[model samples]
Target: MNGKPAVFLDRDGVINEDRGYVHRWEDFSFLPGAIDALRQLQQKGYLLVVITNQSAVARGLCTEADVLALHERMCAFLRERGIELAGIYHCPHHPQGSVSDYAIACACRKPEPGMILRAAQAHGIDLSRSLLVGDKISDLEAGRAAGIPSLYLVVPPGQDEDLSSLPGVQRVSGLSEVVERMFGSQAMPSS
Candidate 1:
């Protein structure tokens, strides 16, 4: 990596509660320790990039403007907590989607590396030195495809405990654990 390492975050489950088709600010809720973890990462000199898949736009559950509004609110909230997002990218396509224009499969989806690759190019990021924090298998795959060396999978609340079978990825209970693993205990500020 030319610069400091980066942490690419998945929006829905990693940053906010994965309420299905979350396009409205009213439905957004930051998960426990999310903002704190982000601030920690930021303090450690890690660029924070949010990469998400908003297929709900394709399903017509919400419009692109709604998604932008939601992101604006999310960014503002994070800024209030002293956390700043380096960049945000979201794919608004889904195969077999309800909306005719957005129904086709696209390269920016979770399983695809398009979004990550684009972010890397835009920000001059080195994927091999960066990490990805996500809550799903697709996120891991996308990170792998983008050549990121480390992938941290967040186990959702009430989900099964087993993670032994998730290959080539590290499983963490939450974003705090991820920060500890990536930045180490010494990287944390005194509480």
Candidate 2:
């Protein structure tokens, strides 16, 4: 906490309900306990950062501006709750994108460490002390690649991701469990 260790979060599924490339504010919904979890982490003095991949932009489902607008909406919600974000980094590129400008194999995409690394540089984050929470394997991979010490997989109950073989990665059923696992259940979320 003294050195600006960050809690890097994936946007979809981790923060918002992932209803297939959700880009509009109307479609956005905070996952249960996400706000509380984030508030708890923030109270512990961890920088809250979001690193996500929005391939929907590449597929023309939405524009980059739409993605930014969605992030603004998310931040607005957090601000209303008295929480602040350190940074929001997203990659709109896809290797097989329909849009030529985003078609290349970009390093910012998840499973790669570009976005997280860049955010660390921009926000003075200590990657060695950082933690990442994501809902998928690729999210864990990105944290591993970025040299983050911890990775938490947020999977629903009865779902076995079978990722136990991986070192330093733990699985949690929800964001509340994420805060519990890292900081113990006694660490209550601040209002």
Candidate 3:
């Protein structure tokens, strides 16, 4: 394991409420205490990397530039909270997408580990020491494939999904809880 650890995050559901193809800043909303959790992770020297699947681009719901704009807004919001992300990786392909060229089985999609592997290679991140926090089982599976030891599943309020059947994956109410588990009592209070 590398001395420095990284926190790989899922954009939708985990970082923000899964609002269904969030392609605009107006549609983006950060989950409760998410900024704080990210900042806490940053304070602990963990490189914050966002690995997300943006199939909306391929489905014709939005364009790549639209996704980038939303991400820019997200990064700006994080910056206001004093959190700097190391990198943001997104996969814009979907097997049954509407776009003419993007409709194909792509390795970069979630559950494939392509995005995570690419991020690891680009950032020189040690997967064994990294933690991946996501809201779906596919995220955990990708993390597993990428060799990320700590996998956190975030279940939002009123969400009926249960992932207890998955072994070696920890469940959390939100990113805040994951931060607590990672930093223990030493975790700083969110501003």
Candidate 4:
């Protein structure tokens, strides 16, 4: 397959309000302007992919099936709105997790680049031209390691993380800001 550019997104905070360890459809809420931003990005010819680390499974807070169910619902919700995701890759491992099966330090977790690299290969994505948008430094590191040149950090309100010192990473208030900056007002498509 020919290589195409993609926008790698972090699921929790970037697409939905990260109500810590969200594993149920009832608890999921799309962030404001997220749907429109996704629609615009897709209209611009970028494959949309989600690369996330779901430690809740390892922590025993939720089962892997629970996470998968949530993701299925999320994809359906987006598809109903005309935004189709190229892929959704999630890592369910943590070094200190309580679930032995998913507790080992895995390569697919954020800061490891395993998921992004795998996604690029599986989807024929051109890492050199792709972009990643996430709310954590680990997300940026993963994208960078996967050779994605553009990285965006979504700084939610009241977020205390100091990411200003990080070189080569741009900070935005939310998905809307990222969309506005990338496409410009003139190129923005109506939702």
- What would the per-residue lDDT of candidate 2 be over residues 1-191, giving only the tens digit for each residue? 23689999998989988899999999999998889989999998899999999999899889999999999988998999989999899999998989888877989999999999899988888998889999999999999998898899988887888786677688888778888877785788456
Model 2: residue 129 alpha-carbon error in angstroms? 1.2
Mind sharing the TM-score for model 1? 0.92
Q: Which candidate is the best by lDDT?
A: 4
Worst 10 residues of 3 by lDDT: 156-165
Give the per-residue lDDT of model 3 (tens digit) for 1-191. Answer: 45467899999989898889988999888899888898888888899999999999899999999999889888888888788998899999998999978888988888989988888888888888889999999999899888888999997667666666668788889998998888799999877
Q: Model 2, which residues run further than 4 Å from truth?
A: none
For candidate 1, list the clashing residue pairs, or say none.
none
lDDT of every model, 2 decimals:
0.87, 0.90, 0.88, 0.91
Score candidate 3 by lDDT: 0.88
> RMSD, each candidate, Å?
1.9, 1.7, 1.4, 1.5
Q: List the residue pairs that clash in candidate 3.
A: none
- On a 0 to 100 scale, what is the lDDT of residue 140 in model 3? 92
Candidate 2 has its poorest 10 consecutive residues by lDDT at 182-191
lDDT of 2 at 150: 89
- Alpha-carbon runs more than 4 Å astray in model 4: 158-160
Residue-level lDDT of model 4, residues 1-191, one tens digit each, is: 36999999999999999999999999999999999999998988899999999999999999999999999999999999999999999999999999999999889999999999898899899999889999999999898888889999998777666766568788898888888889786557664
Local accuracy of candidate 1 as per-residue lDDT tens digits, 101-185: 9898889998899999999989888888899999888888899888898988998657754446556688787888887787685
